[model samples]
Structure formats: structure tokens, C-alpha cells
Target: MLRLSKKTDYALMAMKHLALHGDRGASSAREIAEQYDIPAELMAKVLQRLVRRGLLLSHQGTRGGYQLARPATLMSVADVIQAVDGPLTVTACSTDDHACDQYTKCSVRDPLWRIKDRILTALAACTLAEIVDDTSVPTIPVTLSRRTPAPVTER
Candidate 1:
């Protein structure tokens, strides 16, 4: 499964929160954390990383926190993911030399490459504003769960 790291997830959540609130001023990490039920320390670290990445601007002292360094509409989901998780490639071979033994004869390699490109492109096209404003439609997947029945109890 393609999953985002907890750090990335929290970062997205924090950014979304800021985007939703708009440019009223900076938001403290503690405030954002408490509002979102995230750990203050972890969120603070994520926010700091975002600041260093130029995605957010941080203010210090009493009435200080963070604000978007750029407009939310200008920030892409891929940007956020990349800032935290490095690259979005699903396979190790996607970014570097073919480490897989089947690379020489893999029939699915080309198609997989195409899929990765399409996915990254799509993600790049989507912006934080689109995610937080609800102005755009999102494509979410619905999975059915199959639960096994429990064994009969002993007499």
C-alpha cells in the first residue's frame, strides 16, 4: 500500500488547518497541535521543517507561530510530500539504478514507469487550496472489508 509517513500526515493536517484559517496571522505549534489532537512536540518539529523548506514562515516570541510562506494555491501536495518524504516513487528503481533482478527483462517496467509519472503529475497539479477549500472534487477509494467468522464455542 502507498502510505504517507506519520510526519507527512501531520504536516499536511497542519498545513490544511492553516489554509482553512486563512492569513489572519501565524499559528503557534501548540495551538495547531491541540486543535488537531496532534503531539505539540512532533507538530512543532514538522512545522519547523516546513519553515526550513520555505513552505512556511515561522515567527518567534510571545505572539508567534507560523504562516504559509507562499499562497496555499501555489503549494502542491507533491511539494508537501517531497518536503517530508523526499521523493514519491513507489519503487526503489524508480529514482535510481535498477536494483531489481527482473529489471533487464521486466515486461511491466514501462507501464509502471508511466503510472508513476501520471501519479506524480496528478499530485503536482493539486494544490493545498484545492484540498482545504473544498472547491475541487477529490477521488477517494472505497475498499470493502472481509471479516472471518469466529469459531464455535466449546460445549
Candidate 2:
């Protein structure tokens, strides 16, 4: 199934929180965790990973915590997910050959690879700034209608 891991979800949440706050300087992981009802320790781990990935800047002293390493406009959802999850791969064969035994004779591999590429491309095209900017965010193109189709008139 196509899905983001929990760590990636938390990382995005954390980044969004920072983006919304802007240059309020650093914020404690505890504060972010509490605000979002996320586990503080898990958030710390996710934040540390982000720091290592250079997406986040962390400070250790008193009045210290974490902040965005760059403006939200410069970051993409793919970057955040990659920072936490290492890479966005929908299939084992695409990410690591050892993870799947059917890497060689899989007839469906090519189509699955294309689907993964499309998903990654869409994710890469979306920036944190685009998400933070309410008016610019794209809406999901889905519609639910309850009306029955009108009966055809006899000619």
C-alpha cells in the first residue's frame, strides 16, 4: 500500500509548525509535541533526524530547541519525507534489490516503477511554502454526487 510512515508524518507536522511560526526563533520539541499531541521523545528523534539531514537547525543550550535551517519556500514535502524515511519508495524492488526476490522476473515491475516515479514527482513538486500558503495549495479533484442520471428523452 502507498503510505507514509509515522515518522514522516511527524516530521511534516513539525516542519509545518515551524513554518507557521516563521522566525519566532527555536521551539522546544516538547512544546511542539504537546501542541500536536505527538510523543515528545519520538518528536525529538524525528527532529534530530531532520537536523542531521540539514533541514532543521538544533540548539542545545538554555532557551534552545529547533528551527528551520532554510525558509519553508526552499523545502519540499519530498525533502521532509526523505529526511525522515531515507527515501520514498513504494516497492521493495525499487528501493533495494535485496528486499524483494522477484526483482528479475517481475512482469509488473515496470508499471509499479512508473507509479512510484509519478508519486515521487508529485511530492517533489509540492513545496512547504505551497502548503503553508493557504490560497496556493491544490485541492483534491474528487466529487461525490447523489443525483441519478436524467432519463433520456425519446426523439
Candidate 3:
């Protein structure tokens, strides 16, 4: 199954936290980690990676921490995922041509490529701002419909 790495998850959470508290000024990695119950060391590393990727700005010394390098609305989910986990790949052969042994004989390669592209487009369309803002919406109610089973007849 396709899934995002834990690092990516942490990165997204951190970004959302920063965006929410942006007006309060920068936040330390420890503060974010503590608020979310994440490991401080791991959060620190994640924040550092984001800074290196140019998605976050780091401030040093007392009362200093990290902040978003750009507006959250300008940053997509794909950007955070990519920054933490590199490129997104649905299949082994999606990235490198030699990644799969059946590279030369793969019949579904084109279809897989198209699927990957669509998935990326969807991810790119969603921004951190949209996600953070969505928190205020009421949860949709889910209703399950019950269906009666058909009687089995002997042939």
C-alpha cells in the first residue's frame, strides 16, 4: 500500500503548527514536539530538514526558533512530503528506469506512470492552508445503509 513516511507526517504537523501560530512569532522545535507529543530529537531533525529545504527559516539564540519561509497557502502537501521523504513513488520502477527487473518487458508502465501523475497532481492541489482551515469545518455525518441478502436457490 502507498503511504507517507513518519517523517513526512511529522513535517506536515510541524508546518501546520507554525502556520497556525505564525502571528505569535517563531516556535522552537521542542515546543512543537511537546505540544504534539512527538520526540524532541526527531522533531528537531525534521525542522532542520525543512530549513535546509528552504521551506522554513531557523532563528538562533534565546527566544528564537523556526518559522515558515513562505506563506502556508503557497506550500502544497506534496512540497512538505517531498521535503521530508524525497520524491513520491507509487511503484519501484516509477523513479529510475533500472529500478525494476522487468523494465524492458513491463506492459503496465505507461498506465502506472499516468496514475502516478494523477496522484501527484491531487497532492499538489492541496495546500497547508486548506488543511489547517479545514479544521474549523463540522465533521460530516456518516450513515451506513443496510441491505437485505438475496435467498439462495438450488439449481
The prediction achieving the highest TM-score against the true structure is 3
Report the C-alpha lDDT of model 1 over 1-155, residue by residue, as the tens digit: 67899999999999999887756888999999999899999999999889888999899999788989889889999999888888777665754677888888888777877888888898898899998976684775757669767889999
Task: Quote the positional error of residue 45 for candidate 3 in Å.
Answer: 0.6
lDDT (tens digit, per residue) of candidate 2 on 1-155: 88889999999989999898857779999999999999999999999999999999998888899999998988999999999987777666764464566766688888988888888888888899887886897766758689878999999
Give lDDT for model 2: 0.88
lDDT winner: 3
Model 2 superposed RMSD (Cα): 6.6
Q: Which residues of candidate 3, in runs, are more than 4 Å off? A: 135-155
* lDDT, candidate 3, 1-155, per-residue tens: 88998989999999999999999999999999999999999999999999999999999999899999999989998899999999878777865567687888989888988888887888888888987898643344557569767889999
Q: List the residue pairs that clash in candidate 2.
A: none
Which wins on TM-score, candidate 1 or candidate 2? 2
Deviation from native of the Cα of residue 58 in model 3, angstroms: 0.3
In model 2, the number of clashes is 0
**By TM-score, how accurate is candidate 1?**
0.81
